[model samples]
Target chain A: MINNEVTKLLNMTYPVIQAPMAGGVTTSELVAAVADNGGLGMMGAGYMTSSQIREQIREIQQLTEGPFGINLFVPNEFHVSEQEVELASNRLQPIREQLDLQQKEQVDIPNFDKVSESFQQQIEVVIEEKIPFCSFTFGIPSKEIIEELKQHHIILIGTATTVKEAVENEKAGMDMVVVQGCEAGGHRGNFLSGDQESLIGLMALIPQVVDNVSIPVIAAGGIMDGRGLMAALCLGAQCVQMGTAFLNCEESGAHASHKEAILHAAEDETVLTRSFSGKWARGLKNDYINEMHEDESLFPAFPVQNKLSQDIRKAAAAQNKTAFMSLWSGQSPRLAKKQCVESLMEHIISETRKIGRKV
Target chain B: MINNEVTKLLNMTYPVIQAPMAGGVTTSELVAAVADNGGLGMMGAGYMTSSQIREQIREIQQLTEGPFGINLFVPNEFHVSEQEVELASNRLQPIREQLDLQQKEQVDIPNFDKVSESFQQQIEVVIEEKIPFCSFTFGIPSKEIIEELKQHHIILIGTATTVKEAVENEKAGMDMVVVQGCEAGGHRGNFLSGDQESLIGLMALIPQVVDNVSIPVIAAGGIMDGRGLMAALCLGAQCVQMGTAFLNCEESGAHASHKEAILHAAEDETVLTRSFSGKWARGLKNDYINEMHEDESLFPAFPVQNKLSQDIRKAAAAQNKTAFMSLWSGQSPRLAKKQCVESLMEHIISETRKIGRKV
Candidate 1:
């Protein structure tokens, strides 16, 4: 019903995007379904191996000729000391007991120094496939890498938590920027620091980002339906990238328990905690988080905490226990329903039109 | 441009309610001007004594025949121990020295147990005058009093920070509720433990409140214009209450420094700190707050801290030093302008129409 630069640039029928949620939730089928529905479906390559990402992209390419996107987590460099690991392990030991995990501590925690290779390999896959669109979160890529992606004629969209970060993305010559607010689910794409103080909410962050930046802006966070879409556009966002709205899509690879947890979530149930991944992420707060989220010193930074909690998360998911799984959800998770992406897309469009008629 | 139940209930042409900002900001002139322009203007009676509020109400009655609102801060009970006071005073000594205040600790702080009298007297005035609209923040009023207000045909509205708070307001028999989000400037209306974690943003808060309570919903916080009205309406809000949007209106009673600070605010500059009132509030983060906001233990409980910092706020306002003033502002403070209320209201109506044409 509405046309904008985002719809034109991404070559999609609508300005809505199925936000590329990382951590194995956004599956190839989900991407294909959203793309088939005329929204830009994004293939999340953050946790995928180079081969896995390539195969997924190939599957989507075959499923629909409609343009889609690939999302990558820009890797950060950090040193994890043995003491921090020990402290994290010790602190997590009590939580494992509470969750009744078979293992005390997760094994095979990837070393950050060695993480660059996998990240670089994934980037290579993106470049080789000549993906039409790509977005990066957690941080920004280096100038050389950005230039290489641009050389392939890929449009790069950067994620920002604050205006300062959005300006940095523009300075890096990103085609567009996603202004992710605090109400967003999963890990916060905060590159400046690990503190929660930098977390500004969407209503407050959008207008500020719009006024300061010249590039097209994509609004993300608590948006769940067409009302959210309308609100985002009113706030000056050219497009909206919604994760939670598509979180329970039938084609989504999210765990069954994750979907159920989202459906059962109340308005204020989600809490922004680093207990799951050592990075601030909003998820439906459960017994597991309440017990372990008291101290930050006990968590060993980023990938370390993310990797260490995998066993517990996996065990919880296997048993279908909502308490222990990292049910990444926005504050508006209550709005989520278990539907196919196409059906959900139809609902959003219709609802937005209904509201638009009266507006 | 838009019509809803809120406009009909409040007898306004627009679905906009000028927020009743406390701390000497919402002047009688501003209230009358906004009401005269066909919007439901609110007279902030949060800081005034019963006599002062009565005088202000009478003054506004003479200035404009249009309907307006009166806001009262529901009182809280707390006892600040000598040790807590001493600890707070000790921590504040350094900051006081920097500000060049002759005295160290402010004396004659009002007691919360005694705060009941003043709060009770204000309620008596509202009842006596048969005020058309009344709203409460910080906590819910007693049931008996709510019933009395309803008997008098007072359209009672309650302020809420979360869904639980909104439900509580409805349970107490409020006619409507104001869903104030974290993006709201001034003291958060949180009656729960005074922590910033309870602060939820507008995008995440509005829909949740709308569904949980049967009462008509008024969305507040970070809403700056008619675009905000359209968004709130789409989210199921019957009306929108905006504070920072009109803080710099020509008829506002805000200090020059206060207005200036809001006009120049950045996206992430505001912080929800207890340093100002011992109640968590969002305001432009200044050098004084930066120096003293490290630990909550360093501040005494509510009104004591509010009383302790009175001299600094007064002195800063007089000398035009924004660094030491509270400078209460919502997240979208940058959207504020030095203009008259009537003209700003007209601009908002026109802009909403322009955006509506595209939608």
Candidate 2:
């Protein structure tokens, strides 16, 4: 039997959650589509400003009265001195030359102050709007912030890469923890402090997380179908969240080329790289990633590097050259079906039902 | 406690098996090492003849009294008419020009009759020697042959890619079924009749096969450590078989370059291609595979293409050029440790124990 906390929190017949894919792929229409089809839809407010987040929430609220979630990127503000930026920039000189850009240009460093602004503003908006469900990635938020949010009756969910991280999330006052495997696309929610990152994939990560944490776990990464959903549930996850599968739906705001790439991708084509942004993320292999990998020294710090590559990425997307665009997708992107969001959700539910019946 | 049938059938303290990584990587020494460590070590017979298989089995037998298994590839004998070969040859003319080869060279189709001859002689040896376990890949053998092997008290293990294939293996009297997921390296075990090739990964495939078939299932592909081992056990698998992890052990016969490549590989570096042998197989991305993908017409039929590339592969290996070799490995190759086989097995057991303690 399903746990009552999850049942009440998700407001869904099945404990299936659509992962909030930020930066234009997940739209109000997509979220509402899943919500209307009896699964929790998530609005990704990771990159959006407070005003934009509020507007998007209003749009989703108008479409569906059922419960939904909004995902945030818990910012990490590590200071990078100018000397560090210059050193990293010098390493990227070859790439600049390849792009016909002038060398000796001043290296830009991102202001960590922006993180505090984003978090404070987003939290205020969430409190005012009384958003029922909220989830965070990258790292867990402050204990006080979580306490304040919980005071407003908001359910707090945290994302984790390792079992230790999952346990930490539960201890940090999160109502549930999301076990994000290395197979997951986009920025890695690696909160585990270490010399080198430990990547525990979904199959190995889930059961351990379930066993270690006292809280409910929402399994994410590489879950694309009913079989995956059922397997996650059987592995002791209270729910499953999928991003890549939902990214290809018609209601999604992903670019046409991005959708096309997802539809035609093979199983092993996706790769995880820190080239796209300063932090590690998974996406389809492209010339930009290949070039960055070849000239690793030239890349700058995280948010700054991401900002610098914005123009080239925009130009590539406009030109329909997928070879340069960031095609973020998970390992099971090939299993994604290009159907209406509602129909896809229905298919998932039906498949899960079939599996349950057999069991 | 572990199942009695698996222990009795495999002649091991535990039912866990190490996959045979043939083509010299899986050495007699490595097989003996695993058997000595109390796990069933398999010798890959994919590229070997009856004589080579006999020699390897004898070598392993001489080193360890514990049980081991032999893997055979069911020849894909779909006949391409002479005209088809001529047409394929004509299409490959440009590739010949690119290589500066003479234009009108004769193309010889490899004799696939050797597949049956090899298997027949190998079966006689297995029966005479009372080999404890034998597994088939690519597809299952005939019912009469499987029955004959079962009569001799030899365990018959059949590999399957889908639920339908697992059901078929069960009906054909296989003692157990190995669920090979898309995460598996080397040639895909897709039969000609099953046109629908579902790329369900290990996590999704293992449980589905367990639920669909009554026979005990062994999970293969992408499992490198004890965490993977425990997860498979929790998902209802009786045992786990790993290939890539064992490919880098001191006892393995893999070339230095190949071993180094596997050790240096990232989780996302592997890809599946049919360019190597005209059959879909997974390997590390290299110049030869990348070039062939860019020039698809150069690829011919199975054994013919495999034979034609032999000289180039051998030349590349002799010169220690990695770009031309087939570096077949799973996604978890990066996690592979360069240690002795017994120490590696002990490490895996200790890791599993650590995870078990945490749980």
Indicate the residue-level lDDT of B117 in model 2.
73
Candidate 2 lDDT over residue span A1-359, tens digit each: 23345766768877778898878877899888888887888988887889999998999999988778899988777666676666666655554555555664453455778777788899889989989889998888888899899999998999987666887898899999888866677777886643123344566456657667899999887777776766566555778888888888899888888889978875456766777667778788777778787645455556766766665566667777787778998766657678888888888777765644544
Clashing pairs in 1: none
Per-residue lDDT of B83 in model 2: 71
Residue A173 C-alpha lDDT in model 1: 85
Q: Report lDDT (Cα) of residue B119, candidate 1.
A: 86
- Residue B53 C-alpha lDDT in model 1: 90
Q: Report the C-alpha lDDT of model 1 over A242-300, residue by residue, as the tens digit.
A: 99888788898899888988898776778878888878788888877888868754787
Which sections of candidate 1 miss by over 4 Å?
A98-113, B104-106, B192-197
Top candidate when judged by lDDT against the true structure: 1
The lDDT for every candidate, in the order shown, is 0.83, 0.74
TM-score of each: 0.95, 0.61
TM-score of chain B of 1: 0.95
Candidate 1 lands at a TM-score of: 0.95
lDDT tens per residue, model 1, B1-359: 27767788899988889999887777889899889887888978887899999998999999999989899988888888877877877777676676777756448877876687888899899989878999998898887778888888999999888888888888888889999887788888878533544577788788878878999999888888767777777788888898887888989988887888888877677887889788888888898788887775568778889878888888777777888888888888767888999888998889878878888
State model 2's lDDT: 0.74
